[model samples]
Target: MSLERTAVRQRAEAVLRRLAGDQARLREDQWRAIEALVIDRRRVLCVQRTGWGKSAVYFVATALLRERDAAAQRDAAAQRDAAGPAGPTVIVSPLLALMRNQVDAAARAGIRARTINSANLDEWDEITAEIHAGTVDVLLISPERLNNPDFRDGVLPKLAATTGLLVVDEAHCVSDWGHDFRPDYRRLRTFLGKLPERTPVLATTATANARVTQDVAEQLGTEPAAPAAPRPDVLVLRGSLDRESLRLGVLDLPSPAHRLGWLADHLDRLPGSGIIYTLTVAAATETAEFLRSRGWAVAAYTGQAEDADRRAAEQDLLDNKIKALVATSALGMGFDKPDLGFVVHLGAPPSPIAYYQQVGRAGRAVEHAEVLLLPGAEDAAIWRYFASLAFPPEEQVRAVLAVLRTDRPLSTQALEPLVDLRRARLELMLKVLDVDGAVRRVRGGWLATGEPWLYDGARLRRVAAARATEQQAMIEYAATAGCRMRYLRECLDDAEAVDCGRCDRCAEALFTPEVSPTALTVAQTFLGRPGVQIAPKKLWPTGLESVGVPLKGRIAPTEQALPGRAVGRLSDLGWGGRLRGLVGEGTPDGEVPDEVAAAVIEVLKAWAHGDDRWPSRPAGVVAVDSRSHPMLVGSLAERIATVGRLPLLGRVSSAGSAGADGPRGNSAQRVRTLHGTLTVPESLAGALAGLAGPVLLVDDLVDSGWTMTMAARELRRAGAQAVLPLALALAA
Candidate 1:
């Protein structure tokens, strides 16, 4: 090797030792990546499995580049070309947990590291100052940070101009083809184009398949412009995506209750502290609570969790203070615990790639770590619900663009009534539009850039098709009668995949696959327990007036529905499946099922006896005129009244209602659709007036609670003392 090459290798080795340990040395691939970045200054994409030391490549390269840049700054000739030391390494990580782990990892090597994320809005200025002053070595920020109004318009330009190294961690997200695609990560294309030429960039991910790999590489290589120029020399390093330590297995339980019982029975038998992943936040919380009730040291982690709470849970797992954290995909990326000995999935993730990424969190540093999938019967239903949140249809997208005014900005709330998307979906669409230059986010809200934007219906359809294909692949992965590890690896297009003898199919089923009778009974009882409270909506959705409803701000206390009750959430582990079948879309209206009637009676009994019971027993029962499930609603109401022996006064008549049979849209639009639809007839009015107490208003389901609110308001107007909603299920 040349003297210069020898010196670079020595410096890289020193950094690796400090970052890892005294015996740490750069692997050949690591050395090659470091050399390309520090010496050649080339953009590179590394597709390696988790625990492959991807982070080490960037940190070592950062150390070498910063050192070289510092030396160049001191030289008279170099000083004339550049103003100051280049800048801190900017790592665009996807999760706050990943950012925290990166920041801590940097400090171990004596590198000054800091982070800017949603959780630390108060520290951005200080961190930005440190970056500008050349006092920070590594700077970590989430992908979402790239689109922050202030950061995008202000700090980013300067940071882009001087960044020493750009690292896109979990880089698969940049590709629309990836399992966990985020529109915010698409903003990286613009950020990449803004970076000065010859700035070394590295994209790292553990989950990209060949298609995702190609897409991300193309994005990394090409500069975004009117006429894009592709840099064909982008380095792509692909390795075998295999985790030898992970002993994969799938244990199929008969039902949701059986699955929970299996977990309660077998959780202690897992190798060590780890994560129990669920498909939804509700499932995670329920699973955690159930396990805790069974005397297990566990906690729930989800995107809905507070930042401090997530951090605390992360730390607790890292310190081995808890057996495992019951989590959703929120706990998926960038949580570092080398010795996490097991991963248990309560329900199958919709994509095999995503499942691989999540399970990769386990068996990283241990020689033997257990990985199991307890595929639920409701897995497909849960997957379908999440799939519905994908990009809006062309007409909806057009509606969003149509309402934006070039003369002034409109906040999302201002735009809600004009369009039909939910708040979260609306915000996501806006971000995509912003990145496409159709709309721009300003300080006040969002402004139309007046740029010509075509709706890409074909591409959207293709993406949706791809998602369906992936969902099918995941379903196959669960049922495949082959080596589970090999199946996952092959799903990611890993050519080296082979039947692993360690897998259940290849060897013998490692688990007993049986739930203890006691555990099964307890799980059934836990799941069968019903009654999720429905907190009344205190405020009318903003922009109601724009939607033709003459109300805004808080709903009048007198008119608002009282706190209500449901047999269970549509997403509940125990009752969710049955409820979805009964009340979910496409079911023909019919009399209440015997089991459902029993569940409703149980809910009423508990509601009347619980500490938060109504002020007084309802004097009568009143069914909301549900156009979609009228029979179900009427029968349920009759059942409740009969069981309690309360007077079945009458139904809240939908006689004068003037909208579609089933209202659909956002909160404001739904309210607008239901506003004047319902009224009490003269007979029901007289009966309500005669009664002295509140009535139990019944419906098939409570989603958005606007229907209940509107129905209750009418009941109140008709002389019912108060209206309390009782539904068969609460939509999640």
Candidate 2:
């Protein structure tokens, strides 16, 4: 055998020895898989569960590649005047914490390595240059950074030019079937296509099923080096859902007060280390403030936070300066802290995948950590609110495609008017489209780079299947009569369940009670009803009423109540004073009864007559009105509904409340009874001219009819009739 090959074998043997000493040896299947990888000179994709030694395979592979590359450099030098640059293996990881951990491991092994991410791009560039110049041996990078044009076109080309091997950690992300799907991963296929044919790629992931494995292979443009094996035996634990130490319980109270109460209770109890996962940035900020008010050191992390602030907050968490953190999912992916003892979810995540990833942040040290999912009916409402935002409307996606089809670089400022996407979400979507070859990034922005495409039948089928799978998982979580942990494991992968003795069902055998056959039959029948709204109370037999159903048989009342009531209420309240005719304006004596007059006034004032005013109505009211309205509500209802549908706005405390002058509440400012007055003529003139100035105008309601009429009349008189009106709230 060649001397370099012998050295590589020795290093591999040493790694096996060390890992075996720690009682973590690779199984026979794993070893055979690795052998096949090396022998066939083909790519390998290893998918195993958490705690399985997926990393060990790649660590050994990296060592072997390094040695091989080194020997090749020496051979090239003998033929030439001097040694050429050493093209070390490139590892693309999604998590910075994982990157750092790998760097630390390499350091312990006396292997020279460096990590490049958002944290240290300059240093990354310098290290990459050194790698090109034959100094650095291993280069680790987050997939996000690697997908950047500068890195892909500049640094990666140099690495590929040198015949470098590419290793993708957390490779499941490449698959739409994976729990944490990233759009950037699709671009890796393009990167792979650019590499030399013989340049082997290796992917390692802790979680992947059959479909995910297939996706990974397709994305990397290669077949597996060996046949897939059964799931690993890594002592999978189905831990208790009932965290006794956590004081777990649902809070149905108002958000601000309940969140504040939670912050106060735990801020001083934990080891200055906790995370509060919120559904939005605003909530993160508000929760952070609530904790801070309790005299605890805290920080907020979300998409809205500046990069510097986010970095500072992360550093503080690492340094143990901030005892608690309030954040959205944007903060947790790459952060690591083994000593963190608590993770409190302020709301339910949209899917089990999201919930697993977020909650997985805790208990890294195998300590008795606590995770509390404080979900009430409102939490369900919050998730439904987010789900609507996460999945954009068909028209929005079509508009995006239209904008991209212009064959010109569309700047962010220019594209803002075309779609209802947030800056971050839009950027992510654009990147996804770019990776799919549907669009391309040009000098200043983006342009259409592919054929005009509609959703294909196959793609639609795939989406429907995936959505069904997700919905199945959600239903299981919601209604399963077993340990939550066991249910989650079975849903994720149909692995054998280990009895978690601490869970709610296991500890108390609460789910063992046989459901009444009659009740079950009735429930099944009711569930099968096509369109009828069957109340829970209607399910019981007439003579069985004495059994005493819980909570008046209300299933998720808070989430369902408003929608149920709004339909009937809005119609009765009148489409602009129409319902007021039902109740006489004055009593028989010519003086109106207080209740009668109040009811009449409410019916008149509740009617929303304009675009800006619709948000003041209850959740789902706009949708109901659109369906029931006489006018073709097309796109206008969508636009008005779109504003109320925004996730941040939906979660805001004041959602659905009318403006200052609505019937639900009296005007905070006196309404001008006279309509023909101009409060500030210069300000109005500036507004009408579209100048950069604030203007004040008087109106009874910022609703469709009144505000538009008033603004139109005033601006027409000013001879500038095309002015836009802004308002805080509107009457519906």
Give the number of the best model, judged by TM-score.
Answer: 1
lDDT of 1: 0.86
Compose the digit string of candidate 1's lDDT tens values, residues 578-665. 8888889888889998988988888888888898988998899988877778788888888888889988877776744431233256
Q: Write the per-residue lDDT of candidate 2 for residues 1-732, one digit (tens) a residue.
A: 667445545667676655434544556545544553443345667655443455566666666656656676568654353222246767887766567767766665456778778878568657867887776666887767755667767777777655455778777788767767777877677666555544566777655555666677666653222235222112111222322232222233333344456446544544447788877664566567655655778898887777777768877886779887788878655366656766777766656656655666665554455555654334444443344333344576667788777756876644654555655557767777777677777666788776655645466457556755675575456555666666555545535545455555455421222234443443333222211111111111111122221212322321121111111111111111222222112212122233333332232233344232222333221111111111222222333334445211110011122122222111111112112232324543443453222121212223223323333334434434222222212322
By lDDT, the best candidate is 1
For every model shown, what is its TM-score relative to the native structure?
Answer: 0.97, 0.62
Question: Could you list the CA RMSD of all candidates, in the order they appear?
Answer: 2.1, 16.6
Cα RMSD of predicted structure 1: 2.1
Question: Candidate 1 clashing pairs?
Answer: 657-677
